[model samples]
Target: MKKYNNLAEGPDGFVYTARLPLSSATLNWLSCLIRGHLKKIGSWWRALSAGRIAGIVLAVLRCDQRPSDLAGGNGVHRTTVSRWVREVVGLLAARAPRLDRALKKIARSGGGVVLLDGSLIRTPRRTGTETRKNYSGKHKCHGLLVIALTDDKGRLVWVSAVRPGRTSEITACRHYKLTAHLRAAGLGAIADLGFVGLDDGGPDADPAVIKCSAVPAQRKARRDYENRVSTLGAPA
Candidate 1:
């Protein structure tokens, strides 16, 4: 990777550049990390090189572009792009254990706090039993539920398996046994009001390990206190 040096001042008083290169050190480290898993197998011609395949995956994930749109822009068939995406996903899945260990090391070394939250990923509408399972009353859309745990710096540490959209955030956490995992890792977690009961000092709850802010009430002072707590608990 090369350093970016083409920055220019625009009319709007903002500096702009065409390309930003990754640090050579970082690129080399990443290359060495994935080199073993990205080995070539059968002697067959490939339309896109390994670099291009990685670029396609990053664009789709970071830019949130559709496969068809990316295919058109890259002058490749949609099926080819889709296949590359699946291949990259499988490669990452296979390396999940290594990734988890790395994150655990960081958490333990730094004694960093973890932030737990649930998000809904939109999906196409479905019929029959699927409709009931994937419909989110809160978002008024069909989606999948995913619980993510991030470090205090907002870097993702772990993500739970997808659940139906209708599942509450707290329910999903329980289903995934996230509390035990957090306890085992010896890391504290901060969650939003949606996980109210999680830190309520119940027989199964560990208030010290998992803390959550109280939901805002009708009174103005109560709402202000809740807001302050939320602000304090939010990850940097």
Candidate 2:
């Protein structure tokens, strides 16, 4: 995580290390974007370049290392790395408006079908009241649930805010009003059996917003089709 001082330049440009997991061009672009935003804040730290900060964040995420471990590797204080991570997250959140606009445009163009699914991110087991809320019966672990949306090609388009592990996938989607947003953008959505009741709307409902593919009546056929859809809809 320490600044990659001995960077080797390939024919394409400066080469990123395996741990960083980004092309040099992409790193540079992200650095510029992050730097521009930091400059607007009067108290932004000037000790590290935007590229270095971004590299640290990427390394931590790719390796799934704790902030303290990342700081030790990067030869920086733990608090410093933690602050950098928070800043990077805030910067990305600030760009949501632009990201949403682009997604809406893509949906309207009918570029691909939207697939909805839920996943759990593991968390440490808690005690007392918190334990029940974070325990996931299906996963047999304590975690937070996240509903994700991906295009037909399996590219992530949107992700709902994290909910407790006990929260049903459909319930989370309703809280986020995901169907309304998709319908407003004139996009269709497909989901697994877990979202079976999603299409059941009143007389005023628009059926196109949620498209449930027919599951074969035969047990073997239904299982095969479910497996196929699961493979296709798996998040990238």
> What are the lDDT scores of the predictions, listed in order?
0.65, 0.70
| Candidate 2 structure quality by residue, lDDT tens digits, 15-124 | 22345556888678768878888777755775577888787877776667678766655567899998888887777776654335545866656553477889999999
Q: Which tens-of-lDDT digit does each residue in 135-204 have in candidate 1? A: 9999999999998877767877777678999999988877766666655555557676677666533576
Leading candidate by TM-score: 2
TM-score versus the correct structure, for each prediction: 0.69, 0.74
Error of 2 at 14 (Å): 25
Candidate 2's C-alpha runs over 4 A off are 1-18, 97-103, 208-236
After superposition of all CA atoms, the RMSD between model 1 and the true structure is: 10.7
Task: Report RMSD (Å) for each prediction in the order shown.
Answer: 10.7, 9.7
Scanning candidate 2 in windows of ten residues, the lowest lDDT window is: 227-236
